[model samples]
Target: MSAGPFKVCMLGDFGVGKTSLVSRFVRSTFSDKYMTTVGVKVDSKEVARPGRDPTKLVLWDIAGRNAIDSVSANYLRGASALLIVADGTREASLAAALNLLMQARGLLPNAFAVLAINKFDLLDRWEIAPPTLTQLRRAMTVFETSAAAGSGVEEAFAAIVAGLDP
Candidate 1:
């Protein structure tokens, strides 16, 4: 199978673990620190799909949006796909994630998106409602990921790569 290169942008709210998620998926590492991403941080990973060729995912971890309206749409212009992340323990993050997804999709109508609700390892303290999960799932391919515990991260990344078909 021939390898294809795709640019995938990561979207979410501040402190929703966007950086950590990318770090975990790309470097197999995680940190509990809360550092802000200024503009866009790019990382690369080669993913193998089951019946298809490997894909080179150029993940662009965009800066967390204060609101969907404030996002720089230009940052998402060339993206082939998206990974909208949310924090499971913060209900507002999920709301923000949805809003971000909506706005980003509108900007790049052709880009495929995956909803990633991060910090799933803290499900015991999760504050998001069932209806919220239902909404996100209905919206796109959703993944419950934990960068700290390294759960569901690979699947989420793989899901994005598998979806990058021409």
Candidate 2:
């Protein structure tokens, strides 16, 4: 397959830091201010692969609607990958992320999916259990990320790009 400007949809519940994750990965910047994504926000980043041309990932940061309704499904159209995020401080958000992943898979069966449990910096307040992480690992590549601290941000993006390699 060609090194494409692949469409990667970012899905999660509200306040999961989808925007922050994207900002940190794409622009190497993070902000404390919370801004709800209206409709969808589009951003692009070129990821380097060894011995191949860089892959351009066109990231679609979708609004944090827990359910995949008609409007959300439309925004996810043509996606080749997904970055499903969840707030580590909120266990319910993790469940929501998983559900969103399921819905996204139903829509785009072949799209590469990666799970990111954000806010790793706040480990003290983390609620996700080890067994849960282990279970998730059996399904998809899981990364603990901190958008504020810029941890695992690049690796998560790179892993998705690598997964897209054919």
Q: Estimate each model's TM-score.
A: 0.91, 0.98
Off by over 4 Å in 1: 1-3, 68-71
Single out the weakest 10-residue window by summed lDDT for candidate 1: 66-75
Best by TM-score: 2
For residues 1-166, could you state the per-residue lDDT of candidate 2 as single tens digits? 7579899999999999999999999898999999999999999988899889887999999999788999999999999999999999999999999999999889999999999999999999999987999998998899999999999999999899889995
lDDT of 1 at 9: 89
lDDT of 2 at 53: 86
Tens digit per residue, CA lDDT, model 1, 121-161: 99999998778678757758998999899899999887877
| lDDT for position 94 in model 2 | 96
Tell me the whole-model lDDT of each prediction, alpha carbons only.
0.84, 0.94
Residue 123, model 2: lDDT of 93
Best by lDDT: 2
